[model samples]
Target: MSREKLLEVQDLKQHFRTGKHSVVKAVDGITFDIYKGETFGLVGESGCGKSTTGRSIIRLYNATDGDVKFRGVSVHGKKSKDDLRIFNQKMQMIFQDPYASLNPRMTVMDIVAEGLDINNLAKTPKERQARVHELLETVGLSKEHANRYPHEFSGGQRQRIGIARALAVDPEFIIADEPISALDVSIQAQVVNLLKDLQDKHGYTYLFIAHDLSMVKYISDRIGVMYFGKMVEIAESDELYKNPLHPYTKSLLSAIPLPDPDYERTRRRVEYDPERDNDKSEEPVFREVKEGHWVLCTSKEFEQYKEDLVE
Candidate 1:
């Protein structure tokens, strides 16, 4: 992957106000970069703001605070219609639920060609049909299925349709918000492999959001661990897995099941109770505990991590 940054999310926060006047901190101040041609995995438990982060960067939700930059252009900032149109075409998203993401009223071709239609990428009806057909084949769907409704397909096939739609605009970046979570375990691999192959062919960057750590490890070049709307740690995939710094990161890694039966039985899971565990007085600062590895911690923890490296 190139060292050039494709997207930069700086101190992003998304808050929702409840009827009771309480603010829900869906995504509170997380920062990271996705390098060009690399999959940046964001992993955490349910409701940890993984999807919110993806949506915020893609401008699906207006960010409450902070900046999202794509190729030096502010994503959430006001822009001319032409610039916004370019932004819309360059960035795309794939939702978690395949069944719900596609419109039942539309055929697979119409759904896949939605982006092309909106962007006026195709001029003629024949061109649109050919483009849709090409996208379907690219995602491993048959041309015969192009006229079929989403209800007629299985979960995995529906997701393949979603992928085809995301690729319709020829996006350079894709925010995959838990793309495989709703699919069957057996079919999940196929979808993931399809994504990997597509990336290989197209060199697209990804913000792959998921709670499934194992699958994230398989697909991600680098991984960022999230907990309760905060980024706990980030590092290269194997480095983060082998040397998890934060308590939250360690706890998350411990939950990943081992393939060996003996190890699985003997492994002790790390428990994380944020209330009793993390210091709530001061806000956590992300520091480089090692080169290319960052951990959110107080000054004391940073020193401790430094000392541990020496020892």
Candidate 2:
């Protein structure tokens, strides 16, 4: 991973007022950085605010607090229409649901060319058509499919179209929000591999948000674990899996099932009860227990983690 930061999210918070008195903190005070030309995977269970983080960063929803910066420019506050347009061109997002994200009324050509049209990337109609076709092919779809509506395509094909649409603007940073989660098991690997191949060819930076740890490990240079709208751990992909420091992280890693029958039978699930594990006396803070490995813990727990690592 490059030392250069492409995107920086500091203390980002997104809260929703569900009722007059009740509020939901979808994302609360999370901080992380995505290095240029590297895939940073954000993993957590559903409702853990991983997806919310992506949406807030993309400016789909206004954050309640904190800041998000792209190459040193703040994305949260107000900007001119021209500036917003430039940010939109540089940063694109792939939504979780292929069926819902795509327009049922529009043809694949129109859908993929939407970005091109908005940004005026292509001057002529012929140029636009050619660019759409090229993007379709890049995502493993045929030129013939351009005339078809989103409803005609299968889940995997629809996702490819979504990817094509995102690529239309040639974005430098892509936020893939559970891009493969809705696909079939067999199709999931194909989509993930396609994303990896595209990143490799284009040198695109990614904030890959997903629940699948194994796939995250395969694609990401660095990984962050989130729980209850807060980041619990952050480390290099292999390091996080090998030496998970947080209870929640351990619980998540332990749940991944192996193919072997013997291993499956012997596998133990670690249940993390926050009420039990979390020390009430001291507020937990994100701290580095080892070089490049950070975890949210109280000072006492931080010392314990470091000592345990030494043994």
- Top TM-score model: 2
Candidates in order, TM-scores: namely 0.96, 0.98
lDDT of 1 by residue, 1-311 (tens): 43998999999999999968799999999999999999999999999998999989988899999999999889996789998889989999999999899999999989999999999999999999999999999999989999999999999999999999999999999999999999989999999999999999999888999998999999999999888888989999988877777888878888989789999989999998877777776877999999889999888888877776531
Model 1 RMSD in angstroms: 1.7
Model 2 lowest lDDT segment of ten: 302-311
Residues 38-125 of candidate 2: C-alpha lDDT, one tens digit per residue: 9999999999999999999999999999999999999988899999999999999999999999989999999999999999999999
In model 2, which runs have C-alpha deviations exceeding 4 angstroms?
none
Query: Candidate 1, TM-score vs. the true structure?
Result: 0.96
Model 2 residue 79 CA deviation in Å: 1.0
Instruction: Return the number of clashes found in candidate 1.
Output: 0
